[model samples]
Structures are given as C-alpha cells and as structure tokens.
Target chain A: MKVPILKQGNILIATIQSALTDQDLISLKDNLSHQVIQHRSHGVVIDITELDVMDSFSTRTLRNIASILKLRGADTVIVGMQPDVAFAMVQLGLTLPNVKTARDLEEGLTLLK
Target chain B: MEKDTESEPTSSYAYNLMKEMKLDEEEILHRKAWLEFEEPDVNRLLELNDMAQGYATEVIESLYDHFLKFDDTKKFFEDPQVLNRVKNLQKKYFLRLTNGNYDDQYIQERIKIGSVHASIGLDVKWYLGAYGFYLRAVGKRIFKAFKSNPEKALESYFSLEKLVYMDIGLAIDTYIYQREATIKIQQEAIRELSTPVLQLREELLILPIIGAIDSQRARQLTEQLLHAIRDKRAKVVVIDITGVPTVDSRVANHLVQTVDASRLMGATLIITGLSAEVAQTLVTIGVDLAKINTVGDLQGGIEEAERILGYHVTKSLEDDSK
Candidate 1:
C-alpha cells in the first residue's frame, strides 16, 4: 500500500499504516527521496506508530532513506517507533547510525526547527 | 444426546508431548505392558461402561460433597453456575473412563484439564486427594454391580485403575510444565522491572542502575533506555551507575553500545556515579571509552544533561528581591 506523504511547511510527514511489504517500502524510499528534492523540503518525519513489526529489511530501508535524504539536504527524523519495536530492533543489532529520531511528529518538527 | 457429525481436529499434542518427554510409541506401549493393560483390559473396561454410567451421577455428587467439606477445594464452587458446569464436566470425565478409547485425543483432553487446574492455582495435594476419593467412590459401585461374579469384578477394577493412573500421569506432567512456564514469564518481567528509565525533565531522562549487570540485564537496560529516549523525546540522558557493583569488559561494552544506540535516536547519554574503583576497572580492562560521556556523580550528570539542553540553573529571584 502507498504511504501517504503530507507536506507541512518545509517538512514532509509520511504516516505508515499497517504492514508493508518489501516492495512497498522500496517504493516509499524512492518516492520519499524524489519528493524531498522536488519539494526542496528541509526535513522529513517518517511516522511508524501504526507499524507493529519492523524486520531487518525495513530497518535497512529506513536507514537508507535517511542517508539518501541527507544527501539531498533534507534532514530525516524517524518518529513514533513503538517501544516494543525499539527493543526488538536493538536486540537484533539494527540501528540507524547517525540518523535523528523523535518521539512523535510534533517532536520531530521541533527538532528540525 | 446427538453426536456432532464433525470430527475433532487431530491434536499434535500427543506427538509434541512425546518429543518433549523424549518418548516414542514403544516406550508408551512398554508402560502399558508394565501396567498389565492389554486388549483384555480394554475389553473389560468397555464391558463395565454401561454399569458405570448408571453410577456416574451418584459418584460425581458424592465427589463434590467431599470437596465442599474442605475450605481449600470448596472455594472453587462459590458460584452455583460454576458448580453446575463443573459437576457436568465431572460426569463426562467419569463416563469417559469406561469409554475405553485412550488415544491422542484422550491425552490432549487430560492435558487441557491439567493446565486449567494449574492455572487456577489449585494445589496438587488437593487434586491428589480428589483422585483418591474418586477411586473409592467408583470402586464401591463396581464391586456391588459384579457381586455375583467376584473374579470379573476384580479384573474390571484393575483395568479401571490402569486407565486412571495413565490420566493422572499426563495431568501431573502438564501441571508441572505450565507452572514452570509461568515462573519463567514472571522472572522475565522482574528482570525488566529491575531496569527503570525515569524521565527527569522535558527532553531529559535518567536511568538509575542498581545491582549486578549480567549480559541479559545489560540488554534489558539498553532496550529500556532507548525506548525512554524516544518516548520522552529526550535530548539528553543521564545514566547513574552508582549502585553497580562491578564493571567487567562485558558491562563496559554494553554501556558503550547503549550510548551508541541513544546517539542513533538523537539523544546524548551521560554516564554518572563512576566511583574511583569502577573508573580504575574500566581503564584496567582497556575498554575503548571514546564514545561514553561520563561525569563523577549523579548531581554532576543531571547538571551536564541540563547544560546540554541549554538550561542554566539560576538562583530564585525572591532571594535577590529580599
């Protein structure tokens, strides 16, 4: 399913709903990167509160998206990562090195500001 | 009663249980052989089915009467509806004894009943006592029914005893297994509670570590801190390890990993309460502490965290006004 990306001022907010297949995540990465350059957005917040399980591929994809956005001059702040997901991610040794994270969209925007 | 045409879904429990207990069909057959429960025993039990069904209700009522006399077992039947349901279930259980079809389905049913009893915190002693009461109640009825033929009555009683013992063995195993599983879950919860991540202020969190840091506890500590950092939108974190007893290479590595994970989440972590002994241990162990931001004490840690968040601690204006 397509993740709806909303634009607010100079920031792009992508709210993920339910489970996403690898292909959907790959498309989201492509779409987000493209939108970052087209909109000349200064920051992006990828909300994953609705996502229950985040496997290795999605973790790697998120990190990849952050790096790709960084190259385009847009800072990425992953937000709304559930506590259980964070625990599982840390246990699996998957971390988004050098990437910024926030508690929610409001915090993500404030960090970007 | 009309039999439901739909057959029960085949239970893999019998197979799973065999694997768990490290037993095969030959072992099971050997146990039955040891009990002297051959085809003749099965035939005898089936023959007693009609006569046993006649006394099943009376046996169940007397069993419950015995239960009601004791406060320990009586508490389970506080509600009349529950008592009725249980009494009906007991009747079925009693009748199934003589049904003489002890297969995987039978084992599965016994396990379910055992787990239920275990989950409800029923003491094993009470259940064992109930079994004794049940045996005597049924034995008396069987002996009276076959009074004209004493040899036939003894054979039927032996068959019945063997089946009851089999049921008892399976139920006890399930009870022990369920109890162990519950204990393991409780231990995990206690370990998680041992590491608490407290939010010190807006955009700041504090983790006060106490006790020893095993690999499991270290992992749990890191997980809890990372989650708190995200939940609190913490820009800075102060971890106070004043209560920690030791600092091995493993614990040091875990601390570093925690600092790194927090950094990934855009939170700066400050380690505090590093006593002279722990500092010496870290240096002696030669752990690379380049990423770890440490302070001398908890007060210093909180102060550093405030400074990171751009908070300047100033004296109250009332003091100057006075």
Candidate 2:
C-alpha cells in the first residue's frame, strides 16, 4: 500500500508505518516530491517511529527526498529513530549526511519550524 | 503448626533467598512426599522425637569428636565456645530430620544451615560424610528397636533415609543459590562502578571507562553518556579509556558507536586517556578514529574541552576560587 503523506497547513507530515519495498519507496519518493510542490509546503516532517528494519536504500531514499524537497524550497526533518537503529546505521558504515533528526514527532515539528 | 504466618521474613536477605529458593512450593510438595505414604507416619515421628531427644546430646558429642579427628574439619571450630555453639545447632539440625513436621520453620532453618556451611567454607565431602555418620547411628537404633522382624524395621530406617536426602538436597541447593546471589550483587556493583559520567567543567562531561566493553556494558555506557549530555547540556564529552585492558574489533566499533550517538544527540565527543598499549592495539587493528577528537590523557582532554567551550582558567581567579 502507498504510505499516506498528510499535509497540515504549510507542513507535510509523512508517517512511515510499513516496511516499504524498493518499489514502494520509489513511489513514496515521487509521491512526496509531487505533494510537497502541490501543497507548496515550507516544511516536511518524516516520522519513522513505527518503521523498523531500515536498510541503506531506505536511508538513501529518505536523504534523496530531503534534497529534492530542499530544491523545491521545502525543509525536511526526520524524527523518532530508535537508539538501536542509530547504532545499526553506523555499523552499516553509512551516516546520513545533511539529514536533520529529532527524538519524536513533536520535536520534529519544532525543528522544521 | 502455624508460627509467624502473619509476618513476613524480617531479614531482607532471608526473604529474598527464601523466594529465590522457591521454598513455598517445595515446603508444600517435597515435604508432602517425605511425610506421607510408606515413608514415615506422624505417630512414628512423635515416638522418634521422644527417642531421639535424648540422642541429640550424645550424637552431637560423637559427631564433633569424629570431626576433630580431621585437621580440615577441626579448623572450622576455632574456639571452644564456637565448637559448643555449633554442636548445639548441629544437634537441632539432626533431630529435625525425624521431627518430621517439615513446616515453614523447617525450610527456613535448612536455609540458615546451608548458608552457615557455605560461609564457614566447609566442603561438601564433610557435609555428606557427617550425614552418613548420622544415618549409620540412627540405623543401629532402628535395627535394635524392631529386631523381631527385619522387614518392618527397614521401613522406619528407610524413612530416615528419604528425609535425610530431602534435607541434603535443600542444603546443596541453598549453597548454590547463595553463590548465585553473591555473583549477581557483584555484577551490579561492577556495572555501577565502571560506567560513571563525571562532570569535569560547566559544559564538559568526562566518562572514565576501566573495564571490558561487552555488548551489554557498551550499551549501558552509551545510554549513560547520552543522558548526561542531554541533562547537563554538555558541549564536549571526553571518554577516558586508559584503564581499558584490551580491545577487539567489535569493542572498537562499540566505542565508535557511542561517539556517533553523542554526535547525533548534538554533542561534540572527544576520545582521551589512551595508554600506549591501547594506542598500539588500535593502530594494529587499522581502526579509523580520525573523525573524532583524541587526547593523550585526562589533562589533555580537559584542556581540549575547555578550548571548545571557550573556558579560560586564568591562574589568578581559577586558583583563588579553587
């Protein structure tokens, strides 16, 4: 299923609830880019708290989404990565460069604003 | 039959050990198996109580006399008063075998007995041998009491055997339980002692690590450091690992992971207090720690943290305030 990307005022909130396949994420990338432009959102908050088992591709895709939104004059902040996921991210030798993160959804909103 | 059922065990250690030993269920089940059926009867036990009440003193005297023959066993009784006191405890311990109530007090008393044997550092050989002697002594009495029919006599004798084995099982189990308890306490102490985050400066936190960094310990260390960073709002975190003995590649990665987590949590991390040995080991492993700041020792690390925090300790004001 396509993950829901909701727009609140000028900020876009995407809550990743599923372990998306490569195809699902590619669609997510295109869908988020189109939605951010259509809503003319100034900020996007990606909440991955419910999401687990993130590989390098998902991380890369998220980074790509951030960069694309940035080019569209939108800011992006990811929040709620579990501590073990943070450690695993480092173990895989890929630190998400230029990726802004917060501890939770509320913090993610605050960071975006 | 009911003594102090309304009150909890007064000693926390006793309460915990009793719970750990699962004495509640054992008392109900194990004691039932021994007290019921063909093993022993209440009337026979009451008779045994009267018969063996007189035997307590004589049996204890011989027991200690026999123990004094061995240098190893004799050393456990260093004083005459201690020997006498222990003999009294042992006398009670002996008669309780046939007293046969196997109530809560019986289980508690067995725990105390086992703990004493463990604390006094008595080997199991002496414990089992002492029981063997008591069995032989009690066996002779049984044979004499029922000499008319050997078959009837053996039943009473075998009942004592079953009861004694049950006691021995509780004793050994209590000994093992006490050891495991001691180890658990020591492990908690070690964890607390090893991972301490000390605030060295207003905006500086220092974590001095001195032991092996297993996955469990490393996770605890990381958690402690992260909270200290957030609570103290620390700008620079110094990890002093001079006391660390050796590092495998896995340990190196865990150390790196801790530094990375701190960075993610918005703190600048520094690695310091590396002895020559650890430095050489890191070099051999070809581990890359270039991304994070490093210092030779605590002094150097503090100086570096001060530099980052723009903290200048002028000799005049700093020394006078100190």
Candidate 3:
C-alpha cells in the first residue's frame, strides 16, 4: 500500500492506496496517529480510491483510526469508496467511525482545505 | 462358479472374500439372506417412518397456517417467494427427519433452517412457539394412531420425538449464533456512526460533517464539538460544511447550538462552505447567522484567520508587499 503524506496550507492529505486489510489498518492507525500528533494538522483527508474490499475487521480498524485521530485533535475523512463497496458494507452492517466519505479525491481534498 | 446347493455349509471361499473385502459384513449378510430379511414384513417400519413424516409435516403446516392467521406473523411471510421457500424447506426437513439419518446431514439441515430464520430476523420466541405447536400436533397424531397397536405405536412415537428434539435443538443453536453475529454488526455500526470530533491544535479545531444529519447525529455532533473545543483549548473551530449538502431545521439547530457551545468554551466557530443554495435556503428559512462567523470557503476562512492573527496569508503575498 502506498500512503502519500502531503501538506497543503493548514490541511494534511494522506492518500491511501490498495486494499486496507487488518494489518494495513493497524499500520495506518499507528502512522496516521503519530503524524497527527506530530504535525497537529488542522484537517486530515484519507484518499481510499484504490481500496476495494473492506471487511468487518478492516472496518473496526478504520474506526480505531478515527478514534485515535479524534484524540489527537485531527478531523478525518475517507474518500473514494466505490458505490458498490459502500452498498455491500451497508448490507454487511459495517460502518467506519463517522468518517466523511467523498465520491472522489478532489472532493475530499477540497473538504480538507 | 460353484454349483448352488439348498444346504451349503458356510464356505471358506465366501469367508475369505468377506475378510478380504472392505464392504460392511452386515450389509453383505443381509444381501445374501435377502429372502429371509424380506419375509420379516419390515413394511411396518417403513409405514411407521412414513407416518412419522406425515405427522411432522401436518404439524408444521398447521403451525404455519396458524401463524399466518396473526397479522404480525402474516407480515413475516408477506414476501411470496420467502414464504414459499420456507414452506418447501419445512417439508424437506420433515422428510429428512423421518429418513432415519440423524447423523451430520440431519444436524446440518437443521442449522441451515436456523440460519435462514435468523437472516429474516425471526426471533427465538417465534421459533419456540412454533415448535410447541408442532410437538403438540405430533403428540395428538401419535395418540390417534396408537388406538390399535399400543406398544409398537409407543416405540415409534418415542423415536420420532427424540429425533425432533435433536433437530430442533441444533436449529435453535444456529439461530442464536446468527442473531449474536448480526447484533454485533449493528452495535459496531452505531459506534462507527458516532465518531468524535477531534481538535488537532490549540488554534485549529476541525469538524468534518458527513452523512445525513439526523437528530441522533445532530446530538452527537453537538456533544463532540463541545468536548473537542474544551479539551483542545482551541481558539478557532472550523465547522467544515463541505460534506453537508443542505440542512434541515434540526441540523440547523445543531449547527447553531454548536456555535453557542463553542463560544461558551471560548472558541470562535467558523462556519465554512455556505454553498450558494444553502446560503439562499438559510436566508429563505429566516435562520439568522449574524451571531456565527461565516466563511465563503475553508481556504478563505484560514486566510482570514491568518490576517486577524497578524500573519501573512501566503509567502507570495508577504514578498509582493515587501
């Protein structure tokens, strides 16, 4: 998975590439939590355009990330989940901790700004 | 081949074949003594099996028919396809129970039934009640059939009852398992839906508003925003409304209350991204934003904040002026 960390003005954009598995979720939570604590970015945008499947375990991990980001005082948004994946998640009754979801990365970045 | 004889001693060749072969010895004996076995009139056992199956099917059908009489239960079967499928499965289950195969196949079938019921959100009470009716109907049928041969009838009834109990027990176990899993999923969803707003810095508190802001979400947002403002000791809270397309009265009240709550915690709430339509709608609805700090967009808000804090909005702006 490719995670690109960039700073545009006061916002921090983290573009997450590839499927977010349980391990990826853990690593993401750790890395993003550390970055949020370090930079104290006003806003954080997680671009998940490349993400495909999000199972129950991964959903829990995402929730953990949101919680950690919340403690560090950074807002988090999830972007670019395909509509079909979103629908499946909904059917599976999995939810990712109140994270904002955008249709595309551009909208997510724009929101962060 | 050896010549057939009316009185032939157990042959060594037959014994050797039986010992060497992997086939069941009992089945081989039965096949060899087919005439004697067939003469026992085991038709009674087959008849008893058929009777037990019929009893179970009649009971299940009557139970479902009774359930359909109730408006609530009737609604459960509103989907014709689901109703038909349930009926078909119930018939198949009765036949499997009577087939005397109480091994893994029977257990698995019962489990499948339980899972299907769980998927349709049928509670334990419904299953319990239905099973009670089934047992009662089966008992009544057995009693009616036992009018002639009491001993044989009693034996068959007991066997049927034992099998029914086993199958029903397995089904209930699967039902409970599925229910627990589904409940966990729902609980997880609720937790995910209620994420806390985080304050990243002393000066900047970001609140990402997403999804349809129902009353529940509105309340959560109010609490989260208030907590973030106080905990972070934030000076400015950017209430990003970019994810929010429009606002209802409850959502508008939530936003308004968030501003007031943040003010109480000594923070200025910067309401960002008043989309042209949202701005028009707010005005049309006569919602006064005079007390809230409104911003055209997030960048504009950040730049305005920098100007207020006596910092350059951009390095280019600083150089151009210098």
Candidate 4:
C-alpha cells in the first residue's frame, strides 16, 4: 500500500492506496498518531478513493485514528469512499467517529486547506 | 430337447431374459416415471395427503377467524379485498401441497408463502399454535387409517413431519432475506439524501439545505455539517436554506448548534435564504439572528464573501478608471 503525503501550508494530506485491511489500519493508526503529535498538525485529510472495500476492522481503525488525532488537537477527514462501499458500511453499522467523508480527493484536499 | 413350437412363447422368454439381466432397471424406470407424473404413493401417501390438505384448510381458516377478534390484527385486515385474496391464496397453497408435487418449484412456493406471512407482521406465535393443532389433527387421521399397519403408519407420520419442517425453514429464510433487504434500502436512501448537507468545497463548506426541516433530519444535518467543517479545515461555511419551508424552535436550535460547531472548528458560518415571512417568523419567535451572518440569498452571500476576502469584483472598472 502506498501512503502519499503532501503538505501545503498548514494542512497535511495523506492519500491511502489499496483496501484498508486490518494490518493496514494498524499501521495507519500508528503512523498518523505519530505524525499528528510530531508536526502538531491542525488539519489532516485521508483520501481513500483507491480503496474498494472497508470491513468492520478497517472502520474501527479509522475511528481509532480519528480519536487519537482529536486528542492531539488535529481534525481528520476521510474521503473517496465509493457510494456502494459507503452504503455497505452503513448497512454493517460502521461509522468513523469525528471523521467527515467527502466525494473526492480534490474536495478533501481543498477542505483541509 | 423340446420342439420350438412346444416351448413357451418367444416374447415371454425374451421378457424373462431381460428381467434377469437388469433386475433393478425396472425399479429405476418406475421411480423416474413416478417423478415425471408426480403420482401420489397409492398405498401410503394418498390418505395422508388428503389428511394434510384438510388440516391446513381448517388451521388457516381458524387463524384468520382468530385474527379478526383482535383490534390490531383486524386493523391490518381492514381491507376486505386484500383479506379475501390472502384467504383464497392460502386455500390454493394447501391444495397444491396435497396434490403431491413435492418438486423444487413446489418447495420454493411453500417457502415464499411463509416469508410473505412473516413480512405482513403476522403473529408467529398464533400461526405456530394453529399449525401445530392442524398437524396433530392430520397425524391422528393418518394413524386411524393405518390402525392395522403399525409400521406403515409410523412411516407416514415421519414423512409428514419432514415436509412440514422443510416448508417452515424455507419460510423463515425468505422472511429474513426480505427484512435485511428493506433495511439496506432505507439506509442507502438516508445516505444519498443527506449527502448535499455535508459536502466540502474549496475555501468553504457548502450545505444546500432543501425540504421541510424535521427534528431528526435537522439533527443529522447539523452533525454532518459540523463534521464537514472540522474535517475540511474550512474558514467559511455557506448554508443555503432556500428550499426550507419553515423553521421551528427545534430546527432553530439545530441551526444554532451547527453554527457553534463550525465556529469551534475555526470556521465562520453564513446563513442564506431569509425570505420576508421567515425573517418575520424568526423575530416573532424571539430567535436572534445576531452573531450569525444572515444573507438575503446565495448571490449576496457570495458578494459579501468576496468583500471579506478583499477581492475586487470589478477589475474592469479599475482598469477603465486608470
């Protein structure tokens, strides 16, 4: 999985590639938690358009990442979930706490800025 | 040693040879033929079939009569036309099962019937009780018919039990499938309809509010809008409420929370679509619009935004003056 990081001004954007499986989620939580603390970043956007599916484990990890970032005073936004995947996640009763979803990466990046 | 003419008929001899060569062949053919015609077992199944059909009819009639005694059940059956249709279909289903088809298609139909009953919110307990009574009545009838043949009577009872179990299982599966599908559709609709109220755009979060504001929808809108503002790191948010019919106190409170939430995330919230009547209603209701940026419409809000950002709307006018 490729984790693309871009920094423009005060906003830090991370575009996650591949499906957010359990292992990926753990790595993401660890990496993001470290980055938020290290940079004292106020805004973070995670683009997940490349991901096709998100199971319960992935959703929990995203929630964990958001909560940890919130503790560090950084706000997190999740973007690029396909409509079908979004519907399935909602059906499964999974939601990322304190994280907002956007239609695309551009919109997500624009919001972070 | 015997002459050809003195021997048994040539056809009879050939038949005997074929039978000896393929003894099981005749049984296989008989089974195949039975399947194609779906003939009831003359010796055992026929009597039980009639008994099952009669029992099903009696049970279904009694169940309906029982339902009519209760107000809730009676209310569901208020439409006489629908009730009659269901009753007629139930009769037909019993007849079909008793006809002894027992094919895959018949099994599927039986399952569908069970599922349909479940979907209509039929009292499962009542249905179970009624069905159990019917089954017992049928079993008694079969047992009486085979009073002299104990082994055959037991076999008949077991077969009937098996069929009932299979049909009930089919019904439950169908019911579960229908329920899950319905929930999935509703969830999707909620998500799709709520999308516009939580979108992030460049330099601003734009929430195009439409339709009547119910308390539930208002709360959902507020949460989504706030989450969008926080995640987008937006400095400004434009909420266009042109399609809103009227605002109540609860809706007003939700709007206040939305604005506060945006501010907490370091974003300014701009409220648009203040018609004369709405503005008057707000004042009458003692809902203060102070501390909230109220614009007459989207265009005015945009111009105000341009001014706040220190951008000249008419660069051509500046050039002409020079």
Candidate 5:
C-alpha cells in the first residue's frame, strides 16, 4: 500500500490505513525520506492508529525512519499506537528507543510545536 | 436420547463431576461389584421396589418430619410451598432407590441433585443426617414387611444400602467440584480487580501497586497500564509502590520493564513510594536503576509528572482568618 503524505505548511502527515508488508514499509520510508528533504518539512507525523500487528521489523523501520529524518533536520513523531499492539511489542522486548511518540495526530502536532 | 447423550454431557457440570471423580460406567459397576451387589441383589431390589412403592409417601413424609424437628434442616423448609415441592421430589427419589437400573443416566441425575444441594448452601452434615434418617425409616418398613422371611429382607436391605452409598459418593464429588470451580472464578476476579490504572489528569495516569508482584500479576498489570496509557492518551504515568511489601530482584526487574514499556509508548513513567528498605534492597541487589525515574513518595511523583507536563502549583497566602 502506498502511504499518502499530506503537507500542512512545514509539517508532513502520513496516515497508515492498513497492514503493510515489508516492501511497502521500505518504500514508505524511502518516499517519506525523499519528501522530507524536498519539502524541507520541519516535522513529520506518522499516524499508525489503523495499523494492527506491528512486528519487530516495523518497529525497527520506524526507529530507522526517525533517525534518518533527524539527519535531514526534520523531527519525527509516531502517533496512535494501539494499546494491544504496544503491549505485544513491549512483551516481545521491542522498543523504539530514542524516538518521539504521541497519542494522536493532534497531540503529535502539539509535540512538534 | 442419543442427541442428549452427545451434547448434554459436554456442557453440563454434572458430567464434568462424573469425569473428575472417574465414575465412568465401568468404575460405577466395579464399585457395585466391590459392594457385593450382584445380579441377585438387583433382583432383590426390584422386589423391594414393589413393596417400597406402597410405603414411599409414608417414608418420605416421616423423613421430612424428622428434618423439620431439627434447627439446621428446618431452616431450609421454612415456606410451606418449598416443603411441598421438596416432599414431592423426595418421594420420587425414594421410589427411584429401588427402581433397579443403576446406569450412567442414574449417576448423572444423582450428580445433578448433588450440585443443586451444594449451590443451595445445604450443609453436608444435614444431607448425611437426612440420609441416615431415610435409611432408618425405610428399614423399619422393610423389617415390618418381612416378618415371615428375615434372610430375604436382609439381602434386599443390603442392596439398597450399597446403592445409596454410591449416590452419596457421587453427590459429595459434585459438591467438591462445584466448590473448586467457585474458588477458581473468585481468584480470577481478585486478580483482575487487583490492578487498576487511574487517570489523574489529561495526559497523566497513576497506578498504585499493592501486595505481591508475581510474574503473572506483573504481566497483567503491564497489559492494563499500556491499554490505559493509550486510551487516556496519557503522556505521564506515576507508579506508586507504597503498598508493595518487598522489592526482590525479580520484582525490581518487572518494575524496570514496566517503566521501559511505558516510555516506549511515549509516556514518561515515574516510580515512587520506594520505602527506605526497598531502595536499600535494590541498591544491595545491584539492579541498574539508572533508566528508572524515582520520587520519594506518590505526591512527589505526581509533582514530578506535573513538572514534566509544564504545570506549576503555587501556594496562595490568603488563607488566614477568612
């Protein structure tokens, strides 16, 4: 699934609507990275409220995306992690270390500010 | 009948008690055989059933009269309607005693009766006492009816005694089984009630930990807190462990993991209520507490959370004589 990135002034929003395969995530990371630099967006919010079953690979990808965006001078705030999905990840001992997270898009935007 | 045999056993507690007691047909028959109740005994009970049918109502009434005279059993039959209903059931039970086909169906029915008795809060002492009264009442009739033949009466009475004992055994099993199920359900409810996540403010949550933190309860608490963090959109969490009795290495590890997990979801977890003893235990155990944010007490933890959330509390000086 191609994640559509919406731009609002200097910030970018990417809402994930369904489960994405590894290739789709990699493409999303590449596309997001490219867009961050092209738009010179100061902040990016990746909304995962609709995504269920976030395995280790996705957690690593999001962490990688955050660090990569940091290098490009754009902050990343992962938003809307479902309770069950977060529980499973923590149980699996997987964590998005050194990454900023928010409850929802509104909160994410506020945090970016 | 075939459908009932297939579907009912799987769903009914009585059938479960049967399995738990290992009272399958072979086992039941083995018990009868062990009691020396053979084919001749079955025939003897059939003959006694014909004689007992005439006295079933009389025997049941007298047995109930005995029950009503006792304080413990009398309380169960306070209402006239209940007494009548039970009397009818007792009569049927009395007739079935000698009706002779002691099959799986019979055992299942006995277990159902046993479970009903258990759920109604009828003490086993009362039940056993009632059984004793019933046997004595029926024995009096048997002795009166067999004035001409004592040996035949003895054999018939022995057969009846064996069948009643079997019924008693099955009923006791169901009582124990039902008690165990009730205890298990209560334990689960207690465990669920033990962990509560409270939302103190917008983007702030508090969890007061009490008692022991076994691995199972720790896991449950972690799951509940994570869900609360998401639902409440909490950015700060204050975990107060004042009621916790001990801070063993295992418990310290669980606390550390919980703090880390909450952080992963973008919520800062502040651990508070670490008594001097617990702090000493953690330091003595050499647990890496560097990642954990600790406050001396719950109030301090809440203050710390408020500080992180950009809130300041100011004390007003206008209190005096107003």
Candidate 6:
C-alpha cells in the first residue's frame, strides 16, 4: 500500500502502517519527497510504530528518504521503533547511523522542533 | 523419615546415620562400579571383624600418635576433647569397614566420611596417610595371627588390599566433587559482582566494565542499566570500558544492543573510556557506533553529561536539576 503523508501546518507526518514491498518503498520515498517539496514542509516525522519488519532495502530507503528530505530543508525524525526491531537491526549490523530516532511520535515532533 | 538436608553439629558417633540423607544416583553408581571392579569378599572380611576389633584401639591410637608427631597434622588435633571424640569415631570406622554391609547405606556412610574430612579442611595427604597406616597395621596383625598358615594369610591380605583401594576411590571422588562444586559457586558470584552499575552522581551513572563482555554479562548490563536509569531518573549513563581488554564481533553486537536499549529508555547513554586497542578492535569489526556520543574516559563523559544537563536546564525550568 502507498504510505499516507499528512500535513499539519508546515510539518508533514507519514505513518507506515503495513509491510512495504520494493515498489511500495519506492513510491513511499517519491511520495514523501514530493509532499515535502509541494508543501515545503520544514519538519517530517515518519512513524513506523505499526511496522513489524524492515529488511536492508527498506532501511536504506528510509535513510535515503531522510537524506533527500534534508537537502529539501526538511528535518526528519523516525519514531516508535520497537525494541526487538532495534535489537534485530543491531545484530544484522544495521545501526541506521545517519537516521534520527525518538521514542514515539510526540517525542519525534519535539526533537524536530 | 525425611533424610537430613542440613548438616548435623553433633560430634557423637552415636548419631543415627539411617535418619540421615540418602545417597544420590551418581554416588551410588560410582560405588557400584568400584565394588564390581574390586569384587571384594564382604563375608571373608566380616569373618576377620573379631580379629580387627581386638586391635581397633591399637590401630586408631597409633594413627593419632602419628598425626600428633607432625607439626601440620598436630594443629588439627589441638582440642583434646574434639580429638578424643574423633579418635573414638575412627575406632568404630575401622571395625565397620569389615562389618559386611556393602549396601547403599554403607556407600552413603563412606561418602559422608569423605565429606566430613573435606569439610574439616583435612589435608588429603594426611587422609591417605592415615589410610596407609590402617592398611599396614591390619595386614601386620592378620599375618602375625596366621604366620604358620602362609596360604590363608596371603588370601586375607589380598582381600584387605581390595577394600583399601575401594575406600581410597570413595574419599578422593568426594574431595574432587566438592572442589568442582566450589568453583561453580565462585563463578556465579563473580558474574553477579562483575555487572556493577556504579552511580557517579544523582543524574549521571557509570558502569566501569572489566574483563570480557560475553553475551550473558551484556544482557545483564542492558537490563540493569534500564532499571537504574528509570529508578534513579538518570539523565546520562557512562559505560566505561578502559579495563575491558578485548571486543569480538559478538561482544560488539551485544554492546550495540545495550546502547540501543538504554537510549530507548530515554537515557543519554555514552560509551566512554576506550583504550587505543579497544578503539582499533571496534573499528576493525566495523561497529557502526555513529552519532552516539562517546568520550575518552569517565571524567570526560561526566563533563559531557554536565554540558548536556546545562543545555537542557537553560532551555527549560522543568528539566533535571530538580
């Protein structure tokens, strides 16, 4: 499914609710970048609280989306990552070094501010 | 009756051993294997019980006399009353060794004898030396009594030799088993002591890790850190590892997991005090410790924590300095 990107004033919120395929991630990346440029949003919070799995490709896509959004002058914070997911990600040697993280959506918003 | 789970404080040999603890399967099996190998004639040995009883006092008295002669051995017998009580028990043990029940109860009693010696910190050399005295004393007595019948004396001597070997086996086995059990308990104690979370200040904490950080210890570190942060309401934690000598990939992954988990708890976790060697090890493994703040030592980490605390306090009155 195409990830929903919501706008609240000058900020954009994208909550990934389902498992993402290769094409879904590409579309989601394009969708987030397109919405950030269109609305010229200064802050972005990508909430993946509902996401249960993230392979290397999805992790890379998420990192790339954040970097591209950064060039567009929108600060991005990924929030609500599960502890087990973080544990698994570290074991797989995927620290997502460049990506910003927060405990939840509320914290992510505060960090962005 | 329920067997004795706790040790008895009694010095009396009149202590009812039947009411005591049952032998475990391994002890029973071990004794059975020795009995099979020795093929000791319990009946033949029992027949010599009367002959053994005649000199039981003489055998034990000489054994204690030998113990009192050596400086190391004499120290163990300093209490005259305790010595007398132990001497009486030794006399009875000499008689019962040939009293003929090579049953489970006999095996348990033999094991108990070994445990008592070990518990008293009696040197194994002294123990085996005492057994040696008993063997020679009994053999000398048997031969003296049947000097005219060389064939009969030789038969009895061979049977006594087998019994002494079985006794040695039981005693040495218990000594080895007790030593092994001691090491296991010490290891468990070390594991608990090693994962210490030292609180440096009201807001800052330090876990000065030493030795190898195995997965078990690393897991313990994560849980303890999470609890300490929440309970102490710590703003920052410094995981100091100057004492830790090496870090493999497995250890690196566990450390990363701990860092991630601590951060999730909303504590600004800083891995501080890495030596040059440790820094090289982490880089060699390609551990992506990116974006996570790290300092060279505990002092630098505390300074960083103070800086972070100051920045937060200035930004908001509701922050940590409360």
Write out the backbone clash pairs for model 4.
A111-B232
Winning model by DockQ: 5
Note the B-chain TM-score for every model. Answer: 0.65, 0.78, 0.48, 0.50, 0.75, 0.74
Per-residue lDDT of model 2, residues B1-322, tens digit only: 1111113234555556778777787464756675553434544655677778877788778878998999988886768877776777677667776776766667776666677677667777888899898889888887887789788668777777766777787778878987898999999998888888999878789898887778889878887777777677676889988888887777887888777766554567898877788778888999887766888888888888898888886676455655
User: Chain A alone, TM-score for each of the models?
Assistant: 0.97, 0.95, 0.85, 0.86, 0.97, 0.95
- List the candidates ranked by lDDT, beginning with the highest: 5, 1, 2, 6, 4, 3
Q: How do the predictions measure up, each by TM-score?
A: 0.58, 0.70, 0.38, 0.41, 0.76, 0.65
For model 4 the TM-score comes to 0.41
lDDT (10s digit) by residue, model 4, range B124-188: 56555545755676677778878999888887766565555555654555556657768989987
Q: Which is the better candidate, 4 or 6, if ranked by TM-score?
A: 6
How much of the real interface does each model capture, measured as fnat?
A: 0.27, 0.13, 0.00, 0.00, 0.48, 0.13
Clash counts per candidate, in order, are 0, 0, 2, 1, 0, 0
Worst 10 residues of 5 chain B by lDDT: B1-10
Off by over 4 Å in 3: A1-113, B1-141, B148-201, B307-313, B316-322
Candidate 2: misplaced stretches above 4 Å?
A1-65, A73-113, B1-16, B26-54, B67-92, B103-105, B116-126, B273-280, B283-290, B295-300, B312-322
Q: Could you give candidate 3's per-residue lDDT for residues A1-113 as a string of tens digits?
A: 64668877666777777765566667777888887767768777777656667677876777677777888898777765543445346445563526655435565666667
Candidate 2, residue B136: Cα displacement in angstroms equals 2.2
Worst 10 residues of 3 chain A by lDDT: A82-91
What is the lDDT for B242 in model 1? Answer: 96
lDDT of 3 at B9: 27
The residue-by-residue lDDT of candidate 5 on B23-127, one tens digit each, is 888898887877777888778888888888898888777877888898877887888877887788777788888888878878888887877777677878888
Deviating ranges (above 4 Å) for candidate 6: A1-113, B1-23, B35-40, B145-159, B200-204, B210-223, B226-235, B243-257, B260-267, B276-292, B306-322
Q: Kindly report which residue pairs in candidate 5 clash with one another.
A: none
In candidate 4 the C-alpha lDDT for residue B221 amounts to 74
